[model samples]
Target: MTTPESALPMVVPATDLPARVRIHEVGARDGLQNEKTAVPTSVKAEFVHRLADAGLTTIEATSFVHPKWVPQLADAEDLFPQLADLRGIALPVLVPNQRGLDRALALGARRVAVFASATESFAKANLNRSLDESLAVFDPVVRQAKDADVHVRGYVSMCFGDPWEGAVPFHQVVRVCKALRDMGCDELSLGDTIGVATPGHVLELLSLLNEEGVPTNVIGVHFHDTYGQALANTYAALEHGVTTVDASAGGLGGCPYAKSATGNLATEDLVWMLQGLGIETGVDLGKLTATSVWMAEQLGRPSPSRTVRALSHQE
Candidate 1:
């Protein structure tokens, strides 16, 4: 009993929704980086290839952090070279410090991301430094990357609520975001690391960021689905004029530092919603879901995405 296109339910998008949205696919780097078992370098390369084939223009390839911290991506150096031929794709890598940056630069990485925390407790736990200290550390890294013509993205974690420090103050989040922008980060991704944010929280944060003079165009949202609020929060962000949305394929990531944090908003799920809303993302829903299903098998787990489950059942 399929409904005809003309008879299907109509969705009136909020006036603020952009004509096109940039999906920042963080599956390879952010997704796999948190897996307990290390993914094979060959499989990782194939993952990136499949994502690119699915028309994800901006895919985060890998992280250059020390293997001691994120052993799941220990093969970052080996995995990067295999992706050299992805033409017209922006493959950004995560670099924790100058050492990580050096490794990425050596691999000819054209784009890199640095991480910061909006909460002092998370900062101390995640980076082993205070918020100010973490910003200082990334300053040189961003500067060096920009000087080398490499694009830089700054990630501000725990933007909505912190586990240790509940309901993080608006000023705290704004300060970190401003610091990242001041450090010359080309873009900033506000992370709801613990997944406690509601639409109201998201809207409030965006408003404050706007009030602080952070351009909406350079802002992105990364939400975790722990409490099933990721999509709701994402919609809130989109309605507030955020053009960039970060998602992981198969919903394959969680925060190591924040134990309660869950997998990210699945790319398949986000794509389904975006396409349904007539928002252009240039991602093939069928292909992206197939890729996630394949990757899930390789990991011996079912994908965490509801859209993937529904689509797979149809087959």
Candidate 2:
């Protein structure tokens, strides 16, 4: 079989990197939540199925937030049940409060995430609550989910830099991260919401989190590509022994509050690098590119991912 020049890269394994990495795919949820015009419910379902078919194991299905807040996901009630047919895939949904949690639990969702912010400014802007107040809101949500034996992911956004409060100090982020760990979060994702983080800054935060008692195994990195440093920052995280990564397929979404912020690190771009480095992510580059291209058609825009554009014939 001939490998398409666009499809394959030579594998060259390196030392000091994790043998395998788990990509926390957020395309179906994070990628689509900000669309000005919501994609159809059936198309959203098909996108998730295609992502799973392309070997992404962990897919964030959707958010259960109220329609008034994020009208894009108003179909959560109708959509969650459609995904039950998928087997052996971990479908996690974002729950903003007790009401969001209740709706998710009622739909039989076993994995859920509560998004928090490392800076007070972002918490106030994104959740319309103070940093501590937002955590307070999630405390019972996490506790109740734990009581039900459900897995919880705590997302600490604006971990590196904040638009309102620029260059957030490491100590501020540490406090928020520690709070989530103490609240029984099974895993934590540190987010560079403004896409301003450098490789050194990323390594420093991961090292500090380790010293502060947050193990690398339970921590994932979510980087934005605004400054074009996302891949560099991610490489630094991998060198520090962090394996799980959060990426948006085709590089779809950005911080709505931060106008300068770009999309999340593209999954196609990440997979191409992992494949070249011989890191096993279990993501099929060919099929994943095709999925992104198909999704791009749904949005009537070309994908922003360099790798997707390079590898996809449809694009």
Best by lDDT: 2
Per-candidate TM-score against the hidden true structure: 0.95, 0.97
lDDT string, candidate 2, 117-236, tens digits = 988888888899999999999999999999999999999999999888899999988898899888899999999998999999999998998899989999999999999999999999
lDDT of 1: 0.91
TM accuracy, model 2: 0.97
lDDT of 1 by residue, 1-315 (tens): 222345222565545588899999999988988887889999999999999999999999999988888899889889999999999999999999999999999999999999999988999999999988999999999999999999999999999899999999999999999989998999999999999999998999899899999989999999999999999999999998898999999999988899999999999889878877878899887788889989999998899898888777623
The positional error of residue 74 in candidate 2, measured at the CA in angstroms, is 1.2
Q: What are the RMSD figures for all models against the true structure?
A: 2.7, 1.5
Off by over 4 Å in 2: 1-6, 313-315
Question: What's the lDDT for residue 54 in model 2?
Answer: 92
Model 2: lowest-lDDT 10 consecutive positions? 1-10
